[model samples]
Target: MAAHRARRWSLGGFVLLVSTAVVAAFAFLTTGPSADRADAATTALTWSDEFNGPAGSAPDPGKWTLESGGSGNGNHELQYYRDSRDNAALDGDGNLVITARKNTDTGLRCWYGPCQYTSARLNTARTFTQAYGHFEARVKVPRGQGMWPAFWMLGDDLGTAGWPSSGEIDIMENVGYEPGVVHGTVHGPGYSGGGGIGASYTLPGGAAFADGFHVFAVDWSPEKITWSVDGATYQTRTPADLGGKKWVYDHPFFLILNLAVGGDWPGSPNAGTAFPQTMTIDYVRVSASGGSSGNGGATRTGAVKGIGGMCVDVAGASTADRTPIQLHDCTGVDAQKWTLGGDGTVRALGKCLDVRGASTTDGTPVQLYTCNGTKAQQWAYTSARDLTNIGADKCLDTKGGSSADGTPLQIRTCTGAAHQKWTLA
Candidate 1:
């Protein structure tokens, strides 16, 4: 983690409190589409760690690199991370237990003299990285003030891009003081440190997360990322939510797990804080979209309805290159049957939905062309119901927002208007 990572602040009274416009943007960014969990459940398992090692054994070295130091991980945390089974070990019962204890004998020197606590931090930076998919972990967090546990990720380009430019995704983070809530956040340039974009999910009826294991996850794709707790989605973020800032999560990233004591965000553990608190992890898994590996899954075939409940039809059902795509009545014909494919192509009449001339200009006609794995043909049907061209970063729209039959489709700046909203089956 970098110096500006995961250091959130209270918007109400903190020195980092953002302006009113930013606050309003935050509110809008956190709002997500409904039925997100149902959509996420369809992914196929791709990678996982069950922690089935012998009791008291170290985690599989091939899968994890135990980070050791008193650097505090740029959070001004108190704990000295030790790469020892005393701090992290697999219990006989199929769980990885990370224990944070009051330090006494080790005498590890931290930035502020001797360290007061010892814990563990582990990452998969050396073994694995994935671009887009579903990442999840089942965890029972530790309680008491000053305890911070998280399952998160950093972009693989960290060495080159650096910090926020490399991007970060915090799937789940919990501070002991907020026993009933956990947060999911994304850090990028202009939105690092206390300004990271995210939202919190709280358990119902004031239930404490430490009371039982809960599944925390993120369904991520090129266009959007949805965060969930126990299969219930709380937030979904997209490039449109970035307020013109860059979206840096399109590349592969590696995972990390850590427990820190007394950080700047959580403050130093008080007299009431207990030592030797343990965070138990049952499993961590990753799945690919559409029940298949790679960018997405099996092709989904159906009518892609747009404004006025019209289907996106291939003009004249022609397989010829450069055929225009238009809006027409929903007739269930092959011309109206579009295939949302694994390679991010929208296909009908055996051709791909492409931005004409590979242009990024507004009002560029969206035509059907021979499928070529080019950015011009890539599309992401976002949770906001906008069919966005990956190359243009624009939405599919009917010309002049008209609903008349044979109205040609084009790529334009996304405005969340009715004409840009699509319903893909």
Candidate 2:
């Protein structure tokens, strides 16, 4: 990800930190309607890093390879990348904090100039690499001049093909100058650096990204990649979208995270720039898209009619986190459409029908949440025609057992009542 002193700009659904410990950190996602259109739980949890260790601890050495150097990355960045705990460590608050601090030692120098700052760069080069999948990170970025933080990937064959020929996929790149805008770009032999093909997504309502943690993700398939922020897809790029350029993203690629200062894209830091700037990463996860393979179970879709003929609906056709999944008049709309996946998940609006907070207590209202392949989202069809969430062994019941239209739904003990009986057809 290269940058020039450019003008300030302005730019996934796969358990958006819904765990009880971190739900509030992601409350901003439930503010508006979402447009998640995932067909099923196609992506399987292939790898992840929850950073659930004590404060000042190092990251999982088995999964991450710390990179240290002041090579400037060929961009004249001022940070001398360090592999120590001072630069990267767990915050004991369920986060991995990567700090960039002022380095006063004038003796430390880079190939281009003196290193005035020190930061961290981490990669999964030796441990994890996949050809295609949904890659994501929940990150709260820091703001100030010359701060360039990125979550990106490079072809696994980097040692052989080198630089542009090896290919690069920048899932998320943010420059402090443009706090509200993030970028997604692909670099290849013919189009690298400034000429790379990609686009920028600006947060709505002039919201600065440094305000909170937001999910940055990319759904990578064989022929295309779709970028989304907080489950809303903003841009998509495919081989056809390349405009005749080479599409070098056909093979495996590994992940990388780094914080750099004083790059070509974002100029040097000014007086207002703060030292000890930190980027907090909630988690990094990858899910492999369950392609056209007829494996998990035949993907089935239809209306799930329950008591009083009310159909289960995702509120307002929204797929956002915490959106209510209630019983409503059957309109046969997309929001009312439901799918039963082989993975034992009942999906709607590209999200799974989840018991709120995985609560097993009676009357716990159900909601639409990102499909995290958790038992809380899994539903099994019983011989009694009742849909039981495997996680809690509770039936999908109509609230109050009422037959009235627009009645809400919740999880209750499987009493085999008429209200719990559902027909998927």
Candidate 3:
């Protein structure tokens, strides 16, 4: 009856969706001339569904609609989706839950149930649609074989030209089999469904995307489609490479959130895959132009020492002045300014050291003394590619010990020092 019944979430605000895990991952996937990047157009507030308000309801009718049936257009998938309380619901925990449980929808249920799988498919098919805008969400995935969860967009004129011609933008897609990996794909003419060409990546340390919730986003603009996880970018796509496929990017399109099962891509549920799987959506948000500036102005790479949370005044110096170490905000100030000579040299206050003088001691104030060329400043980034000063062991560090207004700059030691530890790109 009502629209957008919501719930409680950990993402802090009603806009930002939250996931239940911690991965501290950063890296973008696409941007620049990609279909996703064509988001700099159309209605300002357009449409959005965080599925966050109350419970037992469809999304805001002002924004989205529901798509049902087997052989969904093409993907050759199985589930019989619907716009009902049983399929989609606004769980009290601040989530728009589109559960893919193992239930039966009687004859209406496709594939037959206790249809091996039962879930909902939510989309903004007709009605409100925009040409381009930043599409992002915070979500936690369900773990199970044959499970297909996706956050994507499609052309508003689907009834006319149909898929590939109508262009489909898959901002994020992941199978239950590959938990830590994500796929960013585009479908049109030569690149739709089975022939769709896209790339995938496995985040560092074998990160688990299903570990709770992670922010999955796509910066859609005219130039490119940049895919990012937890604010970190990873891949990109462009139009030229689209082999004659219909470019629906120029027209208005809406977003869709669904948990598909046993499709042409994910195949069938395997042993590891579980039942009653749910793709918890913390929020599905749409913002007018000005998509998030990569990591909100976090420099691509800079002097390490003294870098702290969101360029905050660290050590009595102004934020814009000295080389406050660039660190993961809210974690601690110990990971700011670090060296880049290939030796992990984190610098601070004219010194290059990280974390308690690298003495493995606690609370040891990082000093800007000198570069002893010790292991303290010799940090090695795994799977990270960048040019560092492998010779002098000098680091890109902060000079002053002030978190106040503008402070001076320079490089120093390798202590587990609070002022050292820098972000190298």
Candidate 4:
């Protein structure tokens, strides 16, 4: 898929540049942290649009803003986006249909002079913005040589931060040529345009996505963002994957849905490409962490006991940064008292449980670091009893899986081993 581009218009019609291109493919992974924790964690509905309005009605004005223009959207796209029902409307069947049609009689001018196509773009920029949660949509994508449909998001601070600095997250994007595959990507300062980090999810048996509706979603947290198709995870991007580039996704972002007829990425529609292609959206929903008030929902203060009932200890009761965390006899001491904060940090002695150097390599020692708001300090306690480092996607384990006192703790691939299990008590 081509890099997804973003466009923001001002009174003077000036457009800010925001583009995305997938530079690397992430390895496919299993379900995210919350996927298996239904009995332990819950998600509360934050916002939703079922598209259940009367036939031919516009989208709920209170929820979506129709973006109409023809400035090429910074990607040299050919469609003249319009606010008319001819381009977007409800089918009276609980679906929002966004249609792209060949129309030269509208007298609308595009970046390439006379506009040859018309389409619709909708966004929630003025209505809703969320920081960390689950965002999802069910949709049936359009098909043809130049069809490019997407469900994505942009940082809420776009007006001030501008383009790449504001950040972008593409939950789903599909080009006509790749019928069986869809992509998810993230764009930031050094990774914008063709340098975005992303990955693809292909349907089994080469089934075309246009044939039916598929669910696209992302579970976002302070340190990680996981993408899924039909409830199956395809990729997870963390600060560790950004090569030291700034991780600017720590704030709120809004949503966008659009179908373009042609663009610099997908090229123009071919002679065989028929007109009036439609992308059908069944619903769009957002949910917040259910059990608590902050990011990960659960906040508890106590000792995090691990293998053989040993507590996770801050070495030598130190409050200094870089203090090694170890598995030691449970003493209920301050150094062994860990607070799993709602903001995703596991804190003790005024510091956080951190993966030293933010390293993703196996055996990287876990330590007590002064909280820096980086992924290294972000941790998620799962229902499986694993303390997962969001950046490394690994679990806290006793070195050598030993239960001996003073055994150092480190991050290792999550294996559900006895040594990786912990009890917040």
Best-performing candidate as measured by TM-score: 4
Candidate 2 stretches with Cα past 4 Å from truth are 1-41, 292-425
lDDT by residue (375-412, candidate 1, tens digit) is: 89888776798888999999999999999999999999
lDDT of 1: 0.77
Residue runs of model 4 more than 4 Å from their true location after superposition: 1-41, 291-425
Q: Report lDDT (Cα) of residue 259, candidate 3.
A: 83
lDDT of each: 0.77, 0.74, 0.51, 0.78
Per-residue lDDT, model 3, residue 413, is 42
lDDT of 3 by residue, 1-425 (tens): 00110110111211111111111111111122322222322223223455656677666553455555543334545566666667777787778878776656555545333345667776654333444556788888877678778888766555555545767777778876777888877776655655665677676898777887888877766656777888888777667666655454666566678888776566778777667778888887654453334211111223332345233223432222222332233333322432222123433322343333344332233333233445544443322221122333433334454444344333444444444443332
Candidate 3 structure, TM-score to reference: 0.55
Task: Indicate the TM-score of model 4.
Answer: 0.63
State which candidate, 2 or 4, has the greater lDDT.
4
Q: Residue-wise lDDT of candidate 2 within 26-135, one digit each (tens)? A: 00000011111123334445457889899999997756767777767757677887789999999999999999999976887776677889999888664556667689
Clashing pairs in 4: 3-20
**lDDT, residue 258, candidate 4:** 91
Better of 1 and 4 by lDDT: 4
Give the root-mean-square deviation of each candidate in angstroms. 15.6, 13.5, 18.2, 15.9
For model 2, the local distance difference test gives 0.74
Q: What residue pairs clash in candidate 1, if any at all? A: none
Compared with the true structure, what per-residue lDDT tens digits does model 4 show for residues 120-208?
A: 98886654566787899999999889899999988866766877788889999898888899999999898887788899999999899
Worst 10 residues of 1 by lDDT: 21-30
Deviation of model 1 at 255, angstroms? 0.6
